[model samples]
Target: MRFYGFFRSSSSYRCRIAFNLKGIRPEFVPINLRRNEHRDAAFLAKNPQGLLPALEVDGAVLTQSLAIIEWLDETQPGLRLLPEDATKRAQVRAFAQIIACEIHPLQNLRVLNFVKENYDQDRNGADDWARHWIAEGLTACEAIAARHVRNGTFTFGDQPGLADICLIPQMFSADRFGLDTALYPRLREIRAACEALPAFADAHPARQPDVQ
Candidate 1:
């Protein structure tokens, strides 16, 4: 398997966490988003959206971080990334989507760059834009997590599952923007638990091979 990703991308970070949790180490292919490598013709052929964290496995190309992770869970069923129960799976999926769909797309690097280029927005303005969306999304997520927290450790249950994979990376991004995590105690506690695990720790952006 080959994984194309950028070190600092939260979407890529989620995939890294999933791979680590599944104990599957694939060949890492670094995509230089700063240099517009993802926009190159070759990469476009691989992923039409020109997004980071495209995965090539079994002669098939997979795009979208959530889709890729779910495929991994389906194909490699041993270390299940999601719980078996339907209700628990729904809760986990809801939590994951809060980050993947609601929060991340608005704050993605391309979106911020577009804002800077088209609207002549300064870096601070761009960061403020990102923070606004993240704060709103995280507030909703905190409520859901507080309601669904079963074991007091992870978002859904004790074991780190799909929700944890999504939450940890989003927290990393929030920290990057200096977002106040203190408001969300349950979310902070879950992130702390995740960081203590080897899978989440090893998948951190600073630990990625592409990090300089």
Candidate 2:
């Protein structure tokens, strides 16, 4: 298997975490998003969306980080990223959606670039926009995590799963924007727990080979 990704992309980071946790080490193929490598003909053939974190397995390409992560979870059944029960799995997906769908979309590189280009805003203004949306969305996530927390370490259970996979990368972005995480104590605690694990730590953007 070959995984194409950019080091700083949150979506790519999510895939890395899931792969590590599941003990699956696909060959890392770096795609330089900064240089628009993702837009090249070679990459677009693999992922028409021109996104980072595309997985190639057995000559098949898989795009979209969440979809790829779920595919990994399904293929490797032993280490469950989602709970076995139907309702619980839905709840975990909802928790992940808070970050993946609501928060992340508003703050990803493309959206930030769009805001800067269309609004004539400088980098600082674009960053402020990202910070505002991330704060609002994570405030909601904190409450949602509070309701479902069981093991006191993870968002849903004792072991890190899909929810934690989503949260950690968002928190990394939050720190990049200097967003105060003190308001979300439970989320912070869960992040700390995740960081303690080698799987999560090893997947960090700073640790990636392409990091400058």
Candidate topping lDDT:
2
lDDT of each: 0.90, 0.92
lDDT digits (tens) for residues 140-209 of candidate 2? 9999988867655799988889999999999999999889899999899899899999999999999999
> Which stretches in model 1 have alpha-carbon errors above 4 Å?
none
RMSD of every candidate to native, in Å, equals 1.4, 1.1
| TM-score of model 1 (CA atoms) | 0.95
TM-score of each: 0.95, 0.96
Q: What is candidate 2's local distance difference test score? A: 0.92
TM for candidate 2 is 0.96
Residue 204 of model 1 has an lDDT of 93
User: In model 2, which runs have C-alpha deviations exceeding 4 angstroms?
Assistant: none
